[model samples]
Target chain A: MILPRLVFESLLNRRSTIVLTLITIAFSVALLLGVEKVRQDTRYSFSNTVSGTDLIVGARSGNLPLLLYSVFHIGNASNNISWQSYQHIRKNKKVAWSIPISLGDSHRGFRVLGTNSDYFKFYRHGNKQQLDFEHGKPFAALFDVVIGADVAKKLNYTLGKKIILSHGVGKVSFSDHDDKPFAVVGILKKTGTPVDRTVHVSLQAIEAIHLDWQTGYKNPAHAVSAKQALKLELEPKTITAFMLGLTSRLSVFSLQRSINQYSKEPLLAVLPGATLQELWSLFGLAESALLIITVFVVLSGLLGMLTAILASLNERRRELAILRSVGARPWHILVMLCAEAGLLTAGGIFVGVALYYLIIIAAAPVVETRYGLTLTLTGLSINNVCMLLITQVAGILIGLIPGIRAYRMALNNGITIRL
Target chain B: MKNQFISIVMLMVLTACEEPVNSESLQATWEDLIQEGFTPKELILKYQIDTYEADDPRRMQLIRAMEEEWNSAPVNENLDNKKITLTGFIVPLEIESNAAYPTVSEFLLVPFLGACIHVPPPPANQLVYVKMESPIAMPNDGEAFSVTGIMKTESVNNELAEAGYNMKGLSLETFSNESLNPNTE
Candidate 1:
């Protein structure tokens, strides 16, 4: 008790320096934990975007690019699969269900996905969860569109609202399809996926809107009214990609091989789970690099504490000599120094964790809205607890440096004021 | 007091020398999982399946007959409900997509690696569907693991219908070269 009191009083004597060291450690700790949390959540949200589908088929392209463009809406597909090939593949007995996706249009900044009602029925995400309607129902008429949660909220769209789509996938486009506007028939619930930022319309509506733009430009002479365009054949000729659910998972490899070998048109098929793992492994390199850098930041923080303690030892030599004269032992001084380090580390960890929660609470919504990544407020996982334990032990181990030096000084100058 | 201390140390050493009595005793190999009196090679030989040319119409009939024999091949019932350890490569069935690391809770344990991609997967009886209580970091491709569990002869007719055996895995360890010939000792 007396030794702890002396250590506490000693720490208080240099309050400013100790507090500064603690703040450095706290900031470093918070940064380390924040990076790890965001990395974990990003991977989680990425993987949760699509599930239960066995294969994603698209025009011949790299698997990663196809996955990114079709599922994540991150890029454009290199080419479109002919509607004939999609029909032929979906007709195979092994295919349980298929959902065709046509891209290359946008409303405001959101990508417009042209698909049939089968998407609402068969498409799954995040543990096979089905998309539920937040308001209204799936599109019943050809001109009716279903907006995702983000589009509805960001654009302030309601049921029966009229919105026109652009000719291409850009925020600002000159070729606006002002001739044919879609009615918002439904809004999907928040899914924390790219689906939340998409605008869904029927395939026929896509064809209708692009009727006059067949020559890559809307000709004034050939302009067709929206009502007249509906009377024409609105069958889609090509699609960006399509997802397949096989009757049996055992046939996935076989079907994928056959799709890749389709002689009529060059095509590519990839198993979603396997491709996702491959994609994540690529990101794993960058994730590890970030973690390593943050770890070094923490190491430097601990080293700063060590330097502060070691520098203070020179000024505390007289203090130790006085204590020795008052009958304090060398080991007592050692344990007291270690205890002080332990206290600073523990205090820093507590404030760091509190600061971590504060940042998460303040930034989670912004992260979710801006990046579509959900930052879950989970309790300290086993990995976190282990890291904190290692940091605390390192701090105490660092204390041993100054501890042994002070021990030597106390023994060498017993009962002498060397200052 | 010195004698007592030496005797206590000796007792500890003796106890440490004794091997632990493991509850699981049956060490099932790929050969043991096969149904008695049934072999794909024997069927192929008996039907002259390899003798016909690829374009021959008779060859398709013989191949279909061989497939029927393969599909109807039953699991070895004697090993049912037995506590056993089997070593094999994994084919993940239930991937936890949200994990930072690739994690799987359910997977198929096949006798050989690359069974999923390679043509003509192993017989149904040779594939064991293993379900772990919790998800574990998925092993790299072609890596093998030895799983200890209670084996069942029941069929799992889920999306992955290739499995002829189901196992409630209790524990697992990475298969090493030393464990390759487990019965040698």
Candidate 2:
């Protein structure tokens, strides 16, 4: 309406001042939107870490640690469940599917998971979606390997490539399984989870490679050669734990109770969702810290906006009085003033989203290779939509005080003979 | 009143087919036994110290010595027939590079042994994959425990013929059974 023209005219007349105000509003919008996008993406990434998993059963340990080791691939497990216990739990009628995991091995810095083909068939990420193959297929016929997307790309692996494993779980591996090289059979599609950085092979593969080793060193006196070692049986005696899925969700608790209370052994069963929540609980302090930082940033932006606008408004008294003398309504002045805030905020939001999308696209490879977390450029998640709406509402509300003052100024000027 | 009547009817319908078990207490749901004193080891089989931290010599010494007991012979169900208490972490089993066979969800309990950060690495055979039918709460504090359970070992495998513990009938774990299901609420 008339307010937009008035607002534009005011902006044109004082181009430099309005532009500065607009810039400030734009930065605020960018910060708010950018932070919101990151938060939403973080939650999205976390939820997708272990998709398609019905349950992650492990030793009776803290949920976060279990998740930290199993899903996020951070840290290591403190205790191990007895191999005997794993077999008994797997026999339950409710367990329709399961995949055993063995950790504490690494190739270079990437984690080495001693698993089987069941992992390739049943394991999923990114919202219960099955793992898609980028190149090749699941590892089979023993000593064959499957690399994650990030691993293959970073290491520049091709089909039927050979790689060595280390005795330890990190970059500085002591004993390299140089003798028992593995062939790459498959490369997984990008999963946006920790699986991307992982190097997976059969449990038998892990054992076959390590058979001649003892305490990270081969016995100098006598040893079977790698080919000779192959002749020896390579079935694994122990593993880390397994993920399970059941036909009925209701039977989970009963099945869980059965495992924990099985008179024959000491076993712990866990639900993946509950453990993840418990793990995030310990991260509450970090979340609080982030919230505090965000609050300060928002307050600073608002304070800067308030000071800049008020300073400009004080100097525009004569213009306001002229409008009042010209028979313009006070409400019109109010609308004109607040409209500037809305416009500037909108512009800011546009720029911030553009920047984030650009960054996500540019840094995709870097983030993937390093953290094994994939960042998608899909704009405006549901949470982001809600956030933007909230931000716009907040911007408008903050503009109201300045609007009312402009209205009062117009009213006072009407009788001052300024016309 | 109409709303209340409908809500009650809906709740009843949901619970209609389920039978309640009142025989066992909730405490029994978590624990089946309490362990007694450790049976004194004869000469405490000699072991080398693969110590991670030097601060706790007692724990390190005990675990180092116990490593022999862990790896020396297969866990015998009839040994001592005396309730023995042992405290350590329930860690995930490491991938054994060479085994006759292995099964799913395999693991092994180590007595305060180090993780990736502390120790060099656990031997493959010492590792075990854990499985529990029921979900238990995981621990936040890194405290070891006094767990009591009859230990057993057996060969098992999937279609691929992996072998490991036949850990079916293990009893109540203090913690570590968390669920991954999204809470409906």
Candidate 3:
């Protein structure tokens, strides 16, 4: 009963040094937990980018590159699938519906996706969740565009706002589509996917924007005004890739097979989930490395606590000698020191958990906008709980070091020890 | 009791007097043919490539050319325009676009289960394109069914695969053990 009282009073006596140690441990714990949350959430966000589609068909290329360019709006396609090929696949009796994605253009720095109404009708993400509008409706006119939540928030776009897109995918644009500026007709609710950073427009709008430009050059002789271009038939000659939803899940392989062996143009079809698994395998090494680094950080924090306790053990020899004079055994001294270390660690963990929530709440908006990560305020997952338990066990082990030292000092420093 | 009896008699008389239209079409027997002979695996074996790499443009080019050549590969001509009933697994191609409850209208009937789920699909001769008059709700694509249809040895080239035979489906029902029995010689 008195053991805890003694330990608490002793810790309170050296509150400054103990507080410093607590802060260090708390910060380290927060860092570790934060890293884990980001890693898990990042994977969840990436995998949940596209769903309800059976196959992601693109030009013949590596699966990862195709996935990156088509779904993530990252990098660029080496070749585009011809419009005829897209039409052919769309008309296939097996396909329930399809969304033809025409990428390459960018509004400011965000990716511009040229698609038809089918994109809004059939496109799904994050476990078959449909795209819901935050404001206004989908792009109905040729010049109307739908901005994503991140895009609208970042660029401060409101409905009916005017914006121009650049021809290429690069951040730095040499030429812009100044002739035909699109009006923001819609803003989509955030999905925590790359879709949140995209700008959606009609397929014909893409063709109209490029009518004045030819092969990356603005030709004055072939200049077509936006009004004149609108009057002409603006059919997209090619597309970046497309996503297909098949009627039967079993026909996915057959349809994928058919798309792959599509004789008209060499095309490749990949199951999104299967290709995503392949992507994870490629990224597995980096994920493991991140976990290892966080583990080391946690170990260093525990070591810091051990150092603080062991250093304080030297100054407390006289107090231990006094306790020995009063008939307290060497094992009691051991228990007191261990208890103090354990209490400090438990307190630090509590503070760390509190700090983690604070930082997450504060940084949620910035993280989502900058990294497209949706940090949910969830309780400690199974893996995290195990990590915490492991940390506590290691703390107990670390406490043993100073505990044994205090035990040996109590026996050596008899009651009549000369100061 | 008398009123109920009279009403039942009048209903029977009315139903009996009605001429049964399309009775011949519904009652006609179909010739039972073995599906094993449709796709000769030996013919496809010769045309198979070792592996197809994504990076190699030439491999895909060769595959495209090989696929064209494979389309001309010999197929059974006797199955053309014959009223035939065959039991096989379905690989749906077109479905009604009801997100809640979808039904398959166009599908490719394959002899084996899971012909196109994961592994490479069978050759053109092994595949039969079947289009039903009305879409039927298939519990799953892997479930086998018996399709009675007019089979024509017409080569169908869709973006996904090529089928050597096409069938205009007349009726379809889930496969039963008794379906394997030859109904007609």
Clashing pairs in 1: none
Give the DockQ ranking, best first: 1, 3, 2
Q: What overall lDDT goes with each candidate model? A: 0.83, 0.61, 0.76
Residues B90-120, candidate 3: write the lDDT tens digits.
7554444322223456776766753345546
How far in Å is the alpha carbon of A411 misplaced in model 2?
4.8
lDDT of 3 by residue, A1-419 (tens): 68999989988999999998888888888888898887667666665677767789999998889988899887788899999999989899878899998988887888899999999999887656899999999988889999999899888999999988887777668778898888999999988789889999999998888776765688788788878977899899999899998754445665788888889998999776556655666666887898899889888988999999888777777888888888899899888877887888888888888999999999998887666678877787777778877887788778889999888777776776656
Cα-based TM-score, every candidate: 0.85, 0.63, 0.71
What's model 1's lDDT at B55? 93
Q: Which candidate has the highest lDDT of all?
A: 1
TM-score of chain B of each: 0.67, 0.32, 0.53
TM-score top scorer: 1
Which run of 10 residues does model 2 chain A get worst, by summed lDDT? A247-256
| Sort order, lDDT high to low | 1, 3, 2
The better-scoring model by DockQ among 1 and 3 is 1
Q: Which pairs clash inside model 3?
A: A93-B93, A93-B94, A94-B93, A94-B94, A258-B160
User: Which is superior by TM-score, 1 or 2?
Assistant: 1
**Candidate 2 falls in which docking quality class?**
incorrect
Clashes of 1: 0
